[model samples]
Target: MTQDNVPVLTIDGPSGSGKGTITRLVAQRLGWHYLDSGALYRAVGIAAGWADLDLSDASALVRCTFDTDIDFQEDHGGEPRIIVNGLDATDELRTETAGAAASAIAAIPEVRAALRDRQRAYRRPPGLVADGRDMGTVIFPDAAYKVFLTASAEERAERRYKQLSEKGVSVTLPGLLREILARDARDANRAVAPLRPADDAVRIDTTGLPIDAVVARVLALMPAR
Candidate 1:
């Protein structure tokens, strides 16, 4: 299939809403390419910090974004490993600090413009499954299937606490909950590419659902290949 004809499935949601896990599983089931769009921003943030460039400097950030070398290698056993400038940045990219950096830079219109083409380049033949805050509304508006996964902030924070704890990272539930709320406000009110569901996107509440259940629900919404 041509690039234009390649199908795409977009799973958009806030951080810790289980979109990442669900998107990966859905892509694996269909044997399609996966784009962790959030990781791209995180990669940029990490690169900028290393170069001592201010996140508020749009020009510097755009340059830093272009100069950075970021790629994803699928491990199949779990999430794809993110490599930045030939270094394993997978673990670093998952930190709350990296996430906050990403959110800050993502609010810049120029930064988003610079990353737009890179995001689109992931849409290869067969199909693509994209996961991000604005995948459906902005990045992959033409996607064949779109899902907006969400849950209460309390539930999301609890989920994040569990995830971080499993990785041996210590965090307080109250602190995590506060961060989630703050992030929600920042993302939803951002001037450029604010987070919201596409008109045609399906909404799924995964508060108490298992991974398999959420994955199955999303897969059921997919168009037959």
Candidate 2:
């Protein structure tokens, strides 16, 4: 099928909302390509930081975005392995610092434009499952299925805390909660592609749902081919 004809399932949500996990599983179950749009911004931020490039410089940020090399490969367990400049950056990409950096640059119109085509290019063949804050409203509005996953800020903070703690990262619950709330406000009020659910999107509150249940719910929304 042509690129435009390829089916897409967009799962949009705030950080720690479980859209990332759900999108990956849905893509795997359907044997479709997956796009982690948030990671792209993080990759850019991480790369730029290494080069000592100022984040406030939009033109420079756009240049760095276009110049950086970002790739994704799945491990045996089906988790995405983020590669940047031929090196494994999966761990760094998941950090709160990286997340804040991503949120910082994501509000820039130029940077978002730079990554627009890159995200769209992932749609191929059978389909694509894209996960990001604005996937449904911005990147893949034409997608066959759109879902907006959400959870209470406190719950999201707890989920992130557990994940990071298990990874040996030191972080406090209150700090994470504060950061999540700040990011939410910034993302929803950003001038470019602000985060919001599409009018037709199916909303799922994954605050206390099991992974399997959330995945099944997302998959159930997919119509039969």
Candidate 3:
């Protein structure tokens, strides 16, 4: 498909809302490219941490973002791999610390501006399924289909706790709940690209819904393939 006919599908939501999982499934089912925009931010955050730069320094972070050569690839097992400045950082970017740092730097206007073009370049021939806090509202406002998937804070916390535990990361339910709430506050209150559903986007509350149900609801909203 050409750029005009790329048929981008943007799934935007706060963290732990199953947007990532749903977007991957949708992209796989439709044989399209996937853009995990949050991973880009996380990679930048990891790079900044490695350089020991303060997240509040927007100018410095902007410079770092512009200079950073971040690459996203898939391993043989089909897992996403992140490379930062020619160094493999797939493991570093997945940590909670990196996630928190990403949230912090993502609030920086200059940093966002620097990474805008990089994010848009993911739109390829077969189309793309983009997932992030502002994928629909800001990154791809003209996306063919926009979905804002959300769940209750408690439900999201539970899901995150289970996921971390399964990965052998020790986490308490209360701690996870607090972290989720804090991240939500930061994401929604930030001045740049705050998290909100686009007016034209479909909203799906996955609090009591299964993953298949959410995927089905999103698929139903799409134009015929």
Q: Which has the greatest TM-score?
A: 2
The candidate that wins on lDDT is 2
Kindly list the per-residue Cα lDDT of model 3 for residues 11-106, writing each as its tens digit: 999888999899999998889899999988998898888899989999889988987888888899997788899989987776678889999999
Clash pairs (backbone) in predicted model 3: none
TM-scores of the candidates in the order shown: 0.97, 0.97, 0.95
Deviation (Å) of 107 in candidate 3: 0.8
What are the root-mean-square deviations of the candidates from the true structure over C-alphas? 1.2, 1.0, 1.3
Q: How are the candidates ranked when ordered by lDDT, highest leading?
A: 2, 1, 3
lDDT on C-alpha atoms for all candidate structures: 0.92, 0.93, 0.90
lDDT of 1 by residue, 73-128 (tens): 86777658999999889988998889999999999999999999999999998889
Q: Kindly report which residue pairs in candidate 2 clash with one another.
A: none
Better of 2 and 3 by TM-score: 2
Off-target runs (Cα >4 Å) in candidate 3 are: none
Q: Over the full model, what C-alpha lDDT does candidate 1 score relative to the true structure?
A: 0.92
TM-score of 1: 0.97
